[model samples]
Target: MTGTTLTTADLDPHRRRILFRAWHRGIREMDLILGQFADTELKTLEGEELAEFERVLGEDDNDLFKWVSGEKPLPEHLKTPLFERILAFRPEEAFKPVV
Candidate 1:
């Protein structure tokens, strides 16, 4: 998917906003990473997981990029299941060589 294919029609205002932010980070790499993750997981995330996701979205895109790309060690504060899920999420299109 070029970006989020998931509809936000069922999401609450907060979740909808988060989904939008995920697909529109300053950098395209981050946008794909988090946006795809949100598309797959945001609807099921609940309570603290959802809150943690929101907190992660607020982090700097460059830092998030480094962490997700494994270019930098993830800090203790950022160690969470949601972060791990993000690190593991890979949009097939995002990693393909552009022809």
Candidate 2:
């Protein structure tokens, strides 16, 4: 009772499908974003830069969702807009549902 809630079953079929699609899209986007980083950019990162990137990637999926949805404030050092831009990429328009 003290832990996180499990509410996946509460979601309607269409909404659940949308959530699944978004989650998959987000994962793919993260990969592409990381790929865009040059060796120099990654190598040049030190101290806080490296730590922030590590922390962001280390977060669990639920926390990651909260962070992306703006429901939770990202750690100050890890709040780089660059990472957000990378993770927000939409490679496949087919996955994008009409709103």
Candidate 3:
């Protein structure tokens, strides 16, 4: 816990796991995608949405990326509104003009 601090200190165990996992999903793009999701929407997700997110996390990085990017058809079980929201999610810094 040496590097642990205020980031997830106040969160419950479940949220802490989700926050950590979202930011450390192996692939950097996936990390940023899910990490930003954790930062903004994770806290507000309903139980079913949270469950859907967990299912999304269970997917392989390449497949998830394809699904999120619409490069492949979404499997019926994975095509929830929450997944659609992930598809719509744009990182806050994405559209910023570099100085």
Candidate 4:
């Protein structure tokens, strides 16, 4: 057989469903972040900055939990610049978070 390129629609039904669910979850997560940062607009960060913001936010389990839980304030390093970066991120420009 000749080489064939497979697109998302070419996936098996089960795989397609899984991908759809994953995409949905990602969108939901982005929505949650936006809601949490209601005062900020999301049209500022570029792709690379958003990637860095995600990386910093995801650094440690405790860090992620603390940021999400509001139990601990985000550190100045992460909060001042990184959080702003995240708040200004557009989901269309975000790459999927690495598992």
Candidate 1 lDDT, tens digit per residue, 4-73? 8898789999999989988889888778888888989999999999989989989999998787777899
Error of 4 at 32 (Å): 7.7
Q: Write the per-residue lDDT of candidate 2 for residues 1-99, one digit (tens) a residue.
A: 211122447655643443333334345433323333321134444576655555555556565645655578876755586456534642343235457
Cα lDDT tens digits for candidate 3, 1-99: 212223776678887787787777766667777778777787787788888787788789888767766689989987678877887885654334457
lDDT of 4 at 92: 42
Q: Candidate 2 — worst ten consecutive residues by lDDT sum?
A: 31-40
Global fold similarity of model 3 (TM-score) = 0.78
lDDT of 3: 0.73
Top-down lDDT ranking: 1, 3, 2, 4
Better structure of 2 and 3 per lDDT: 3
Candidate 4 worst ten-residue window by lDDT: 1-10
lDDT of 4 by residue, 56-80 (tens): 4335644544564456877766666
Displacement of residue 79 (Cα, Å) in model 4 is 1.7
In order, candidate lDDTs are 0.85, 0.45, 0.73, 0.43
* Lowest lDDT block of 10, candidate 3: 1-10
TM-score, candidate number 2: 0.37
In candidate 3 the C-alpha lDDT for residue 87 amounts to: 74
